[model samples]
Target: MATFGKYFLIVWTILFFNFFMETQAPPSCDHGWTRTPNGEACVKMYIRPPKAWHSARRACRDEGGDLVTIFDETKSNFVRDILAVNNTTTAWIGFHVILTEERWHWLDEDGTPNYTNWRYGYPDEDFWDPMVRAEECAIAAWVNGLGAPWINYVCFVTYPYICEKPLPSKCQWNDTVCLNIHETYDGWKCLKGRDGVARIVWPETYPPGSSGPIISGYALPILRSEKRRRDLQ
Candidate 1:
């Protein structure tokens, strides 16, 4: 009975510690990305040698993100500030009209055009007129009197672009806090995952009480038996 009570207490303590760690974890941005002031999303801008809409998106995807999409006024302002800070007069955004339908859509999974910041007399609805070239893509531009608003443009035109991706979990779990900041772990080496994410390699020897790999504080605990099976393979 005493042994059973001791084991139950140990299990309960471990569960409590894990829960506390997870609840305290905060969202983190990937390397070379900046989080918005409101903590909405991680964003990065490609300014040099501007590319067309499709090319810009491709470039963004290479960095594990997609062209910035603004679903609301807050996101619109966040992207606008990024462009403004960089002195980018104009840049391609993710808003566009699906050629088959006149309705506008965003490049993000939440494609519904719930919000817009169109400039006056813009979008032109030129798609309706067979003689005019369709202005399928949107660009955020600064007007002398008006603040930055979206303007429709042809998709092929080259412009600076912004990319946005969801914030990745910050791996704050380390065996020991070394005095040297760069040396996050004592003897383990850092490795980059295929998805361009950084992960700390676990050394063969581990400190006492290490039940499983510490992927992140927010991740679910992996069973020790399963981990041993994986190690064997």
Candidate 2:
């Protein structure tokens, strides 16, 4: 009986230590990124180096992902916060107005913009006149002096690109929301769920008492089955 009690106590101690380590892990990326513990699901990358739109997509694919495709306000704010932290005026994202001239859509290659986070008066496609049909692909970048609206650029032009991989589903919970905290060349910071009464982080700092709706309240669950398929491939 004495030996059994000692072994039980030892097991309990080990379990406690493991739990502590799990919760105390430091924030994974830098200001604009995160590392999910359950393999690739929790990790993501954001880049804005110049490249043609098609080229950017290819680069992401080659690197195991594609240009950034924001699915919710939290994700959008996260990316925006990173930009603000780095004082990045412009960068490229994976969206464009390809169909019917001005009909904007995400460059998903999957034929759907199921998730969208467009700014006011977006998808204007003003840059493309009927004559400019050939230049349909779009890239996003900071338009210095133009505030936070990431203006579309011709894909052929070289710029940085961001890459992302599905993070482990274990790190995510149905009841929790995630927000981007900060970003740097190394990685980014994403906070999960609201901490108590604190409002969700807004990429655009809002003035006090000027509340309307802040977050767009959309969530994109990383498709686990899709990831499984990729892993098998």
- lDDT computed for candidate 2: 0.48
Root-mean-square deviation of every model: 9.4, 16.1
Candidate 2: worst 10 consecutive residues by lDDT? 181-190
Q: Which stretches of candidate 1 lie over 4 Å from their true place?
A: 1-27, 37-40, 109-111, 133-135, 170-233
Q: lDDT of each prediction vs. the true structure?
A: 0.65, 0.48
For residues 124-231, what per-residue lDDT tens digits would candidate 2 score against the true structure? 565566556555544434444443455555557766555555442323343233433222222222224444221332334444543321322322222336454334
User: What does candidate 1's lDDT look like per residue over 170-207, in tens digits?
Assistant: 33232211111121122121212334332332334444
Task: Name the Cα RMSD for model 1.
Answer: 9.4
Best model number under lDDT: 1
lDDT of 1 at 87: 85
Best by TM-score: 1
TM-score of 2: 0.47
> How far off is residue 231 in model 2, in Å?
13
